[model samples]
Target: MSVAIVGVAECDLGQTGKSVLELQTQAVTRALADAGIPLSEVDGLATNGISRFSATQLADYLGIRPAWSDSTFAGGAVFEMYVARAAQAIEAGQCGTVVISYASNQRTARSRKMTGVFEEGTPEADFEEPYRPLYPISYYAMVAQRYLHTYGLGRADLAEVAVAARAKAQLNPAAWTYGKGPLTVDEVLEAPMISSPLGKLDCCLVTDGGGAIVLTSQSRGVEVLGYGESLTHTGMATAPDLLRTGAVDSGRRAFARAGLTPDEIDVVQLYDSFTISVPLGMEALGFAGAGEGLYADKPHNTGGGGLACCHPGQLGVLLLVEAVRQLRGSGGERQVPNARTALVHGTGGIFSSHATVILGVS
Candidate 1:
C-alpha cells in the first residue's frame, strides 16, 4: 500500500507568547486546511515523546477526539516515526486521516533550565547525576571532536554545512535562521565558540514553535515511498561510539524500501542540531565517504535545518514540511526544480535515535 502527505502546516516559528497547546491547535487547523479536510474527519493523532502538551488537551481544544492517539516520545525523530506509523494506520483502515503534531516554548520558557535532564529519572537526588552527561551542545561537541580526530577534518569543513544551511534559510520565510546571502567560511569560523570545536554559528538556535502534517493512504497526498528507523543509545549514552550513529543502518533500509540510491535523491533534509551532524548524516545516508561528507556540491540541508530554523522540539516536523514542499514543487525561491525525490532525516537524543523517510511525487 502507498501513503501520501496531503497537508502540512506550521505556526509562526520563533514567535513567543503562544502556549504549546494553542500553537499545536493552530498548526492542526492549518494542516487540515492544507489537506482540504475537516477537524471532525481526523481520526488519528500522533505526537512526539518529548512534547509537553497532551493529546487529550489537543483533542479537547479541537473538539474532536481521535479514535487512534499515540503519545510516544523518541525525541525529534518521533515525528518521522509517526509518519511511518500513520501509513500503517491508513492501510489498516484504522484511520483515513492522520495528523502528527509537535510544539514547544524553548526560548522563552526553557530559561536555561536543565529540563531534559530532569525529564529522565534524575539520579541527581541520589547519585548527583553521576551518569548524567552534558547538554546536547556539549555531548554533540564530543562527537564532533572525535569525528575531527578520527577523520583529520578541521572546523573549516564543518563551517561549509552551516554556510549552506544559512543560505537556504534565507529563502525559507518560516525559518528563524533565515538571513542575507550565504555566509562565508571565515564568518562561520570566526563566530563565538559555544562548545569548543563547535562554535556559535555551528550550534542551532533555541526556538519555540509548533508544526503539523496530515497524511492519507489514498495516494491523495505526498507519497511516503519509504521509512526506516534505528537506535544507537538506550535512553542514555553509555556506548563508546559517539561520533557514528545508526543513521547508516536506517538510511540504507529506507533507500532499499524505496528501491532507490542516494544519488536519486534530489534534496536532503539532514537533521542539523549541530554543524557536525550535517556531515555525519551525509556519510550515514550514503551521500559521501565516512567523515568526508562535508562538500559544496551536495544538496543537503538546503533549508538551514534545525541550526537555521531552530524549531525546538518541532525540528523533525519542519524537516518533513520542507521535504514535502520541495517534492511538490512548491518551495518557491528555495525550490529545487525537478525535485521528484527527497530524503528527510530526523534525529533526537544526542543522535541516539534516527528515522529516515523517502518521499516521491506520484
Candidate 2:
C-alpha cells in the first residue's frame, strides 16, 4: 500500500458533555489541520459506532460529500480495520485522501450498560443474556481466570499490568489518571472486585473522548507498511479458545505483508480494555512466548493505555494516534528513543475481533 497516516488527534476527553457528532467534528477538523491539508481534499471516509449510516452521518456532519466511505462495525477494533480497507481503496484508485474518525458520549450519556446488546431472539440473547452477567468484564475475567490458573499466578501478577500503565499515564498530562497519583499492585488488588480476580482498576476508565486519522497517498508522513484484521466470534460462548484471540492470524498476515519481524519493531500498542488483554495480545502477536506476555521486556503503550488513558466507547483510533506520536518522536516524557518501526494491535468485541497494523518512518 502507498498510503500514509498524515494526521491524528484526540478530542476533549473526560466528561466533555458533547454529542458524538460534535466530538467527531473536533477530531476530524483537528486531524486535518494537523496534516496541513484542507478538509475539502478528503474524498474518502470511514466511521462507526454512531448509527447505522455512520460514514454517511459523519460525512454529512463534516460537510464533505465523499466519493468513497466505509462504516464497518466490529467493536473497538473497527478503526484499524478502516485503515486496512482505506489503504486498499487508495491502492485501487477508488479514493484519494480519507478521513477515519469515531466518538462516543458513553460517559456523559450514562449509557454504559452492564448487559450486552444483542438482537431479539439471537443466540447471544437467548443463551447468554439469561445469566445477566456483566457484558464484557465477566467474559474477560474468565480469560484472566483461565490464564492465571494455568500459569499458577495470582491477581497480584495481573496488578502489575495496571501499575505499569499508570506509571506511563503519570507522564502524559492528557491522561485522565495523570497527576492523580501512581498506582500500586496492592492498589489494584484492593479495588472493588468487578469479577473474580478482576478488580475495578483492571478495567478501562469510563470517559468521553474520540480520535481521528487522515490517510493519503502523499508520502510526507509515516509510511503504511502493512495491516490485517480478523474475527473469530461474536460472543464468548462461541469462541474457540478463551486464551487465544483473532490476533494470531491478523498479526501473522500483517508481519508477512510488511516483511518484518517482532524483533525489528521498536514499539508496540496493544489494546488494553482489561489488564488481561495485554498478555493475550502479546502472545498472539509473537511479542511473548506462551505465558510470558506479562513478563516480556518490551516497550509498549507509551501514552498510557486504555487502562490509565482515556477510553471512550472505543479505543482503536487512539491506539493508532499514540503509535504515530511515538514514531514521530513527540511522546515527550514517555517517548522511546529513536523509535522507527511500530506494531499496533486493537482488540474488539469481547476479544472476538482483532486487527494488526505495522507502521514505519522514511
Candidate 3:
C-alpha cells in the first residue's frame, strides 16, 4: 500500500478574526471537497496543541468518529509529523482515510509576544526566559547575528531572502502580501529594524488561518515519498549551535528515504519564519554550502512562504498544501514549471525541531 495526499486546502489568510475551530472546520470542509470525499469516510485525524483533549475535541466538533487520532505538539513541525503518522495508520489497516489539520488565531487573539509561554520549570524558563528576548524576532535575530558573523555575510544577504519571497507573493493572489508589489533587496534592507541584523521585512507576517490535507492508502494523487523529523534543543540557550539547525539531520533522513538528492528536488518549500531561516535551512538541507545558502537564484517558496503568504503559528500544513498544488500543476501563476518533485521543510521552536517531507507525482 502507498500513501497519497488526495486533498489539500487552506482557509482565508490574514486577519479573518475567526475562531480556531471555525478556521479548522472550513479547511477540513474544503479538503474533503477537494478529495471528493465526505467526513464519514475519514477514520483518522491528527492535529497539535497544548490541549490534552484537542484530538477528541476536534473529532467531536467535526462530527468524525476517528478510530485513530493524534494530537502531537511539536510547534511548526506538527503537521509534518501528522502526515507521517497518518501514513503509518493507513498502512497498518488502522484507517483508510486520514485528515491532518491545523488552525491558529494567534494574530487576532493574542499578543505577538513569544516569551514566558514554556513550562516554568523547563530549560526555556530557566535560561532563555531570563534573557527577555521578547518575541521570536529577537531570538531569531540573535541567530541571524551569529550566522552573519560566522559566515562573513551581511544583512544584505538576508535581505535577498525577503525580496525573493515577496516577489513570489506577487504572483500568488491568495498570498497575504499579494498586490503589495514586489520588494527590492535595498528596500528590505532599509525596512525598520526589528532586531539587529533583522528588519521588519525579514520577519514573517502574523495571520489567522488554517489548512488541511487528506491522505489515503491508495496512491491516487501526489505520493508522499518520504518524511523525516529531528529535535536538537527546546530552548535557544540550550541549542548546540545556533547556526546549525536540525534540518540537516532531518533533510538527510528524508532524502535517503526518498532515494533522492538535493539536485533532484524540482521545488523547495523551506519554512521561512525569518529571512535568516531560509539560508540556514538551505545549508542544512544540502542545497548549498555554508555561508552560501542564500537562495537568491534558486526556485523556492513559490507561494511566498510565511514571510509574504501567511503565518498562523504552525505553517507546516500550509507548506504541504503549497507543495501539493505545485505537484498537481495547480499553483496558478506562481507554479513552478513542470514541477515533479518538492521538498517541504518545517521548523519548530527557535531552531529546535525540524521536519521534512518529500512529495512527487504518483
Q: List the residue pairs that clash in candidate 2.
A: none
Expressed as tens digits, the lDDT of each residue in 1-362 for candidate 2 is 47899999998898988999999999999999999999999999999877888898888887889999999878888888998999999999999999989888889898874233446577876777777778789989989999999988899999999999999999999999999899998889889999988999999999999899999998789888989888898777798988888999999999999999999899999889999999878889998998899997779988888999989978999999999999999999999999999999988878988999999997
For each of the candidates, the C-alpha root-mean-square deviation to the true structure, in angstroms, is: 2.6, 1.4, 1.7
Q: 1-362, model 3: which lDDT tens digit per residue?
A: 78999999998778888888888898999999999998999999998642567789889998889999998777788788788888888999999999999888788886454333466688567877777775567889999999999988899888888888888999998889999888998998888987898998999888888799999977689899999999998777788988888999999999998999999899989889999899998899988888888843457899999999999877899999999999999989888999999999988888788999999995
| True-structure lDDT of candidate 2 | 0.90
lDDT of 1 by residue, 41-124 (tens): 999998753335567777777788787877767777878889888888888888888999887776767653433533546443
- State each model's CA lDDT, in order: 0.80, 0.90, 0.87
Q: What residue runs in model 3 are displaced by over 4 Å at the alpha carbon? A: 113-117
Report how far residue 43 has shifted in candidate 2, in Å: 0.6
Over 4 Å off, model 2: 113-117
Candidate ordering by TM-score (highest first): 2, 3, 1
TM-scores of all candidate predictions against the true structure = 0.92, 0.97, 0.96
Best prediction by lDDT: 2
- Collision count for each candidate, in order: 3, 0, 0
